[model samples]
Target: MKADPKNVLVGSHYLDGNHACAEGAIAAGCKFFGGYPITPSTEIAERVSRRFPLVGGVFVQMEDELASMGAILGAAWGGVKSMTCTSGPGFSLMMENFGLGIMLETPCVLVNVQRGGPSTGLPTLPGQADMMQARWGSHGDYEVIALAPDSPQESFELVIHAFNLSEKYRMPVLVMTDECVGHMTEKVIIPPAEEIELVERNYTDKKPGEAWPYEDTKNLLSPLLPVGKGYKFHVTGLTHDQRGYPIINDEAQEWNVRRLIDKVTKNVDDIVWLEEKDVEGAEIVVMAYGITSRVVQPAIAKAKKDGIKIGMIKMVTVWPFPEKRVKELADKVKALIMVEMNYGQVFLEMDRCVAGKCQTYFVGHAGGTVHNPEDVYKTIKEAVK
Candidate 1:
């Protein structure tokens, strides 16, 4: 279906990443937003608050991040495409219910415009420190899909992709962008409504007695039955049967949890997206994502100029970590170099994936800003030697 033109900002504009993300949500047909303002992320909420009303959508400023997360989940179950935005401190507050959203199979989008920190570290600064936390922050054994946008334009595009993936898989999806990218201004072109493809929630067609929220489909994605639709359905965070009833046993535990993990893992190739440049026959591969990916380009260029056959893989999807592809590249490259704002979080994943196949090195910066290109270049040189 084409987007409603009124909600689509169909033109070129110099937009900051946070505002661009809000426009992306609007273009993607998101009708409800619940968020608590936090630095490096408040622009998203402010934009949504002003724009939602004009588009016949709703925006709520919840009491806190916890309430914000809860509100979006409630909105999703009410048959609306919903989202929320936050920084690290607020992101941390949302984790408990984030797990609940996962267990209940809610389809919504959450944007984390990452800031420096263990706790309120640097609100007005950049940090890629939340990459690992995005995967493992919530308690439990479920997998999630996360996309990292490197620029304001990609921020506009990827948030739409996040929503599409969430609806298709019946789970929450995250746009894991950092403050540098979130606040950076760039040109974002929103295409015509018909040109922008979107995935609608696959609502179940079964009668009230036959519809079950957790019913198994061959593809592992059960269609959702929104409340007040005359459907006899149950939704819970407990270990549940196909009928969505609480079941306490090892059998039920494996039955429910495995499906949640498998749905993402089994189809990882389809879920992972990447941009590779000159990887073939390269001695070193530099892996980076979010704003760091942009920062590392000049370094990669310098390495190439200095006769180093250094390649790069700019991560578009960070979670369900492109294990197969990384393993494949690991087997071929002489060494792998990871550069990020955080202190080696994703670098550890690269090391594990390499697994003695090749050497691995990490260049971690403690996030007030992006890496110095010379530092990234120096690391690539060291890795190759």
Candidate 2:
């Protein structure tokens, strides 16, 4: 529930982080939510499942993670904006078909409220352990747009952005949250429907002509028509040509894969987004995102007040890794302190991008809870010298 600022009581009341995320999806015009109830992220599904029925939308709790993901994809193909949520193990189970969604160019959202894990590690705790897995878990070199939010309000806003980006790009966008933000209670202000900008999938008819399912357009993302719209086209996991037919030749495989990859890579500038703290003249910079970034913020403010030239970069979108902006930041800063809750996962990516330009270090811990602000401060002080 969110307080509507328009009349001071127009929209729903202030919802928790999980419910705020559900409301964001609904605000973004999501008509279908298919997912299983897993710890930490279960509230999201429960809330959506309960709310959807009232809005004339569909909510189906699938048998497992695999089926949950599959159902979301199917729903998307049926011209419905859809989503699914889960934890680490469930996310792992969904990856095989996650790649399938990539190949099919399905427009949907996957919300993984990550908990501790290698396998059922900690269901009731906060962890950014799956940041790397969010990008690489599905296997193959494909594009994944992962967003990390530091608060309930952000969890609400980012989910809408996730849906917009997914529809605009025609790819599966992941709104990756953690147990801290998912379970934390906060006053989330939901914007009115008129204020929220929504982007629907493009389905146009060029009049009285056969709509090309996979026409040769300059933009790699072609128009998507529906199943019963009398368009003869194919969708498969194998290599597909422009017309959606399977092409077993080397050149065809190269063309399709290259196009899919290039569609995202070429548009990295538009997709890669972040927020920066005081960066100029900073000797030490701490780079963190998601719930962990919130933990490190107070440390940064204290450092700034103490006249320590410490800066920060709070990344909102993780992949295409924000490589160019990160490289620029690395060149200017003396040291980069990457604070994640994993065993050097996304930290490795930061290292690769900032190599030879500046010093890079990691502040990571994983079990149940996250590192505190004082811990991040200690590392920032150590790395400053």
- What does candidate 1's lDDT look like per residue over 132-208, in tens digits? 88999999899989999999999999999999999999999999998998889999999988888889889988888
Least accurate 10 contiguous residues by lDDT in model 2: 1-10
How does each model score on TM-score?
0.99, 0.94
lDDT of 1 at 39: 95
List per-prediction Cα lDDT, in the order shown.
0.92, 0.83
Give candidate 2 regions above 4 Å deviation: 1-12, 207-209
Residue 131 of model 1: what lDDT?
85
| Per-residue alpha-carbon lDDT of candidate 2 for residues 1-385, written as tens digits (9 for 90 to 100) | 2322331212546667788788888777788988888898999998888777767689898999999999999999988889999999999999988888988888899998989998989999988888878888886777788998888889888998998889888889998889988988888876565677778687746532466555656877777877766675678888888767888999988888887788889889888888887877889888888888888889888877877898888889877788887798888888988998888988999999998799998889874897888888888777776
Give each prediction's root-mean-square deviation over alpha carbons. Answer: 0.8, 2.9
Maximum-TM-score candidate: 1
Clashing pairs in 2: 1-13, 1-14, 1-15, 2-12, 2-13
